[model samples]
Target: MNFFLETLRFIGLCLYYTLEYIFLLFIPVRKKNVAGEIVLITGSGSGIGRLMALKFARLGATLVLWDINGEGNKETARLARKIGAIRVHNYACDCSKRQEIYRVADQVKKEVGDVSILINNAGIVTGNRFLEAPDLLIEKTVEVNTMSNFWTVKAFLPAMLAANHGHLVTIASMAGLVGSNGLADYCASKFGAVGFAESLMLEMAVQGKTGVKTTIVCPYFINTGMFDGCKTKWPSLLPVLEPEYVAERIVSGVLRNDIYILMPRSLYFLYALKSIFSTKAFIPAAEYLGLFTVMDTFRGHTKKAEDKHQKTGTKTPRSLN
Candidate 1:
């Protein structure tokens, strides 16, 4: 009888939440205030990370920026200060190293206070086929793109859990959801990231930590020089997003406490089809959408554009965040 009652309650909640989601879609949700909040964004040296820092700076949030590129990170801090951010801090820490992440995180807590908003924006992609990709590059991809989130959360989540108030954001990719050709390591890392974020969110809810918010962003390719040579067969449907636009949407979603932020809006429909359709049906759709050959011409960042991207890789493997 108890089980039956609980099942009925779950059914009722499912319907109610469905209606709520549809209703909220038609109207804007109220955005929460981030003013005075300490926001730590990894990979803030350039690309989307830098853009997000500027946006948060404008919104009156204290910015903590991290990047392997010290010069670029300082440049971003300078830009933030130029745009009216008075309390911006930049750190030269490689996300690929766990000890570096923990060390910098401790420094941040002591110097800047507890980070109220943690954005795990640091990531890397090899843009090579599975067999053709170098082993070191694969390990680096996983370390930077997936394992970094775990270390960052471990370093700072205690404070958030204690206070029951904080936001954790992961800048994942659409490749996290679906597979693509020639991006095996990149896809696997993103998949791990997506799973970690989702599971952590569920754990927070299960622990009744209502004030702790988690956002997982899965965006399409962006024109940030990371995927410089990548192409889209359907430009109108899945146009390579602009860095500024992605940064704006991410900040907006964080403020709104959105759990999932999929870029291009069309991704929502496509992802839905993944669950609703069978494997036989999905493969053809993916092929039609050019997922199989999306990375056929991926050139990553050229020498001149490396500074604009987030990563500093060795000569052998081209890495981008």
Candidate 2:
């Protein structure tokens, strides 16, 4: 009886906090207008990056689109211009390459004006088991997902600090908040991204640079071609996010200068539970409860699609099955 009461009390407290968080999230706050602002978005070729670029363009911001795929970059630029961006600049550069990032940053500064917003949205996944993942794949994953943030920030933040105003947004993943099988490299990169954003925020706070806001977006599986074939078992607990929905939230968060934006919000509670509960207790329980299988199935399906894509030189559209 005592144990049951204590558990209920804990649940009640968590619920209280959850509701408080949602209320705060939905509450109207002053937003900085993006009109005439210069925004840089990596991986703007497609998926969430492209969606975000479109949103900013609709708000009348000048856009600088960066991606490794030249054709995709051009297409994003065309789309942004069509959507009413004041100006759209496209650059083809591998974000994982520090030198390439430096070059692009210099070019943007000269051609486009100081960037008022920086979105580090470029990321890649190997979709292979830990042992099967080659060393090169692991390195590339870390370089693109983790190191690229550092390079981009270092390249653009100096100007923002000097100007005393800018928004830095990092699009991390829910996987960073929780461990998953067959995603060791991807998870490690995302976890590093979360840590990097948190540490940067703390540094800014300590330095009293409050005007320079940082927002970290940690979202669940998004229905983008990047995660095609991924599946989730708990639709209620972890429904797959739509790219447009995630983009809207991201833009809203940046406008409001929010520090940590966790989509769905409920995942924060699950993260807390994971931390508070013993691994031995929660891991087995989560597995038996069918939670672990969600990401595992996703990984398996993604791996199969990637294999098929490599075997045949044809790309498959995003599909849950």
Best lDDT among the predictions, by candidate number:
1
lDDT of each: 0.92, 0.84
Clashes of each: 0, 0
**TM, every model:** 0.94, 0.86
- lDDT per residue for candidate 2 within 1-321, as digits (tens), equals 699999999999999988977897688777899898889999999888999999999998889999987898888888887766658999998998999999989999999889989999998887767898777778888999999999999998888888888889999998777777778899899999999999998888898888789999999888886766668667787788899999999998899888888877778787778888877887785674354655454543346675788799767432321
Tens-place lDDT per residue, model 1, 1-321, is: 699999999999999999999999899899999999999999999899999999999999999999998998999999999999999999999999999999999999999999999999987787788999879889999999999999999998999999999999999999999988898899999999999999999999999999999999999999998887889999988999999899999999999999999998999999998999987987799898899899998877643345444455444335432
Candidate 1 lDDT for residue 248: 93
Q: Which candidate has the top score in TM-score?
A: 1
Q: What is the Cα-based lDDT of residue 202 in candidate 1?
A: 95
Off by over 4 Å in 2: 1-27, 285-291, 295-321
Q: List where candidate 1 sits over 4 angstroms from the true fold.
A: 1-3, 302-321
